[model samples]
Structures are given as C-alpha cells and as structure tokens.
Target: MFMLKQQKAKIIDEVTKSLSNAQLILLTDYKGMNVENITKLRDDLRKVDAEYKVMKNTLLKISLTNVGLSIDDLSGSLEGTTAILYTDKDPVMALKVLYNFIEENGNIPVVKSGFFERKFIDQAQAKEFSALPPKEVLLAQLVGQIQAPIYSLHAVLSGMLRKLVYVLDGIKDKKPN
Candidate 1:
C-alpha cells in the first residue's frame, strides 16, 4: 500500500511537470479507440513535439491543482476515458494532426475541451484552431505583407528613372550632331 502511494505521488509529480511546460492542453475522450489507433496517434503527436497520454482523472486533477489551475474551469472534462494532448511547440500543428487522425479514424476520439493561451476552449474552438494554417505559412504571409509596400516603392522609382533616361536620349537625338 505504501509503495502504491509512492508511485502515485511520483506519477502526479511527472504529470505536474508536463502540465507546467505545456503551451496547449487538450482533453479528449479516447473511448473506443483501439491500441493500434492510439499508438498511431501518439506517433503523430510525437512528430509535432506533442504528447498524447491516457491518465487517470484523479491524478490529472491533482496535477492540475499542482499547476495552479482550478479543476472547476475544466468541469466535466475529466470524466470518461480522458486523454491529454499537450505540446510546448506549435499548438496548431498538434491540433491539426489530432483532427486529421479523427477524420481518418471515423472520429473515434472526440475533443472535449482545451486550455490554450491561458484560456478554456470548447470543441468548436478546437476545430477552429486546427483550421488555422501552419506557423511557417502564417510567417510567410506576414513577410509578404511587410514587403509589399517596399516592392511597390521600388517599382515606382524604377519606372520614373526609365522615363527620365528615355527623355534624355530623345533630347540628345534631337540636338544637332
């Protein structure tokens, strides 16, 4: 009994550490998902530097408390076969993988709720998050936006220079040789 308690405490500590480091935390109902599917999901998450873990609700609650999060905020999310998807890196990538996996697997696991950027998000919000383009794409778009004016300015300056050169050549040609 004492050993069991010690193990549980260790597990709680590990979970607490994970919770603290995670930038995005999603609670999912992974009921009815087979071992193979769960393994595949874990591999997919791993590729994005995220993790998928099936943890006991009690231990999870304890970990949440340790991380200074109120369980009440999560309310009803801890029930059932809860699996946690957490990532310290790009949250949107992780969410995309999970959503894509769900689509391919007949929606075996459903997202119950999520905690991202220090706020709670529902299923619809999670889907919205997944719909966002990847970080690289967003960054590229921003760079293009920032450079658009510069490109336009260059074009205008070059056009004026070309016109001036043409007028100078015309004047030179008209002058008596």
Candidate 2:
C-alpha cells in the first residue's frame, strides 16, 4: 500500500512538471495497441519533442491541480487506458505526429481530448487539430499568399515599362533624321 502511494505521488510530480511546461497536452486511449506499437509511437513522438506516458487518471487529476490547471472538461475522457502526449514546443507538429500514428495504425490509438493554449478541446476538436498542417507549411502558405500580390505588381510594372519602350521605339522609327 505504501509503495503504491509512493508511485502515485511520483507520477503526480512528473505530470505536474510536464503540464507546467507543455504547450499542449493530448489524451489518447490506446486500448488495443501492443507494446511494440506503443514504443514506436513513443519514438515518433520523441522526434517532435513530445512525450507519451500511461498514467492513472486519479494521479493525473491530482497533478493537474498541482499545476494549477483545472480538469473540469477533461473528466469526460478520463476513463480507459489513457496516455498523455505533451510537447513544450509546437503543438501542431506534435498533433501531426499523433495523427500520422493513428492513420498508419488503423486508428487504434484514439485521440480522446486535448488542452491547447489554455483551451479545452474535445475529441472532435482534437481530431481537427491533428488535421492541421505543420507550422512551416502554414507559414509557407502565408508567405506565398503575401508574395502573390507582389509578383502581380511586378508583372504589371514590367508590362508598363515594356509598353513605354515599345512606344519610344515607335516614335523613333517614325522620325526621319
């Protein structure tokens, strides 16, 4: 009994630390995934600086309170074999990794819910987040969007200059020396 309590306390401490530093905390229910699959998922998540841990919901709830984050909206998804996937950096990249895992693994590891940037997102919303493009890709798209107008302006200006040159050439040709 004492050992179990100690383990729970340690988990609470770790979860508290993780939550305090995380930009996003995703809850997954890996009910049917095997150990090999879970390890692969963990390695993949590690590439994006995210971590996956299976913890007791009670300990997690205690840890949430320790980190000063209310677990009010997370209760609905608390049941089952839960694994916490969290990253201190880009949540979108982390979500993309998780999404890829779910996609490749035939969706066994289900996305339960998420807390991102101080907002409680449900399963649908978590899935939506996973569907998002990576930060670099989105940023690149924005840059392309911004540059399209500039390229058009350049094309218009070049056309005007070409017309001016043609006009000057026509005037010179019409003149007799």
Candidate 3:
C-alpha cells in the first residue's frame, strides 16, 4: 500500500511537470482497454509527440491545484477509470489525433473533457473538433487561399504582356514588308 501510494505520488508529479509545459491536457476513460490495446494507443500517440499516462484522480487534482489551475469543472470528469494525455504542441492537433484514433479503434474509452487554449471542451465538442484536419494541412490551405489573388494577378499580367508582344511583332513585320 505504501509503495502504491509513493508510485501514485510520482505519477502525479510527472503529470504535473507535463502539464506545466503542455499546451493541452486531455482526460479520458479507459476502463475497458487491455494492456496490448493501451500499448498500441500509447505508440500511436508517441508518433505524434504526445504523452499518455494513468494516474489517481486525487493526485491529479492536487497537481492541478498546485499549478493554480481552476479545475472545478474537471471534478465531474474525475469519476470512472481515466487516462490523461499531454502535448507541448498544438493542443487541438493532439485532441484531433486521439479522438480520431478512438473513432477508428472503436473499442477504447471515450474522451470526458479537455483543457485547451485556456478553455474547457466537453466530450461532444472535443470529438467534433478532433475530426477536423490537422494544423499543417489547415495552415497550408489558409496560405493557398491567401495567395490566390496574387497568383491570379500574376497570371493575368503575364497573359496581357504576351498579347502585347504578339501585337508589337505583328506591327513590326508588316512595316518592314
């Protein structure tokens, strides 16, 4: 019992450190998952540079308090078997990745709540948001959209210049003839 308590304390400290630097923290319930499934989930998360771990809800609450975070809403989410995910990268992308994995796997736990960009997202909102495209793809699409006008202007100007050059050549040839 003492060893388990110490271990829980260490896990809380580790989670606290992760939360300190992480831009997002997601809590989920993994009650039905087995070791193999959990390992697979962890590996998938690692590919995208996120960390997943299990910890006692009480210790997690202590960590949140220690960090001066307001976790009142998170209290309800603390019930039931839980796992936490943290990432220093864009929190949205992390949520997106995990939620997508859950969607595909079809047998894991469900997301309960998320802390992202200083806002709390409920399970439904988290699922909806995570289904969207990743950050890079969204940024690339935005850049392309922003540059469309410039690209079109350049094309139009080039076409006009080509026509002008063709007219000038025609005039020159006729004059010499």
Q: Comparing 1 and 2 by lDDT, which wins?
A: 1
| Reference-based TM-score of each model | 0.87, 0.83, 0.78
**Which whole-number lDDT from 0 to 100 does residue 81 have in model 2?**
84
Query: What are the per-residue Cα lDDT tens digits for candidate 1 across 75-169?
Result: 88989899999988999999999999999999979999978865788899999999999989999999999999999999999999999999999
Supply the global lDDT for candidate 1: 0.91
In the range 1-177, model 2's lDDT, one tens digit per residue, is: 245777877778878987897889888898999999999999999999999988777777787778777788888778878888899999988888888889899987988887887678887887788788888899999999999999999999999999999999999999997
Q: Is candidate 1 or candidate 3 better by lDDT?
A: 1
Best prediction by lDDT: 1
Backbone clash tally (model 1): 0
Ranking by lDDT: 1, 2, 3
Residue 128 lDDT in candidate 1? 98
Candidate 1, superposed: residue stretches over 4 Å from native: 1-3
TM-score, predicted candidate 2 vs. hidden true structure: 0.83
Model 2 misplaced stretches (Cα beyond 4 Å): 1-7, 104-106
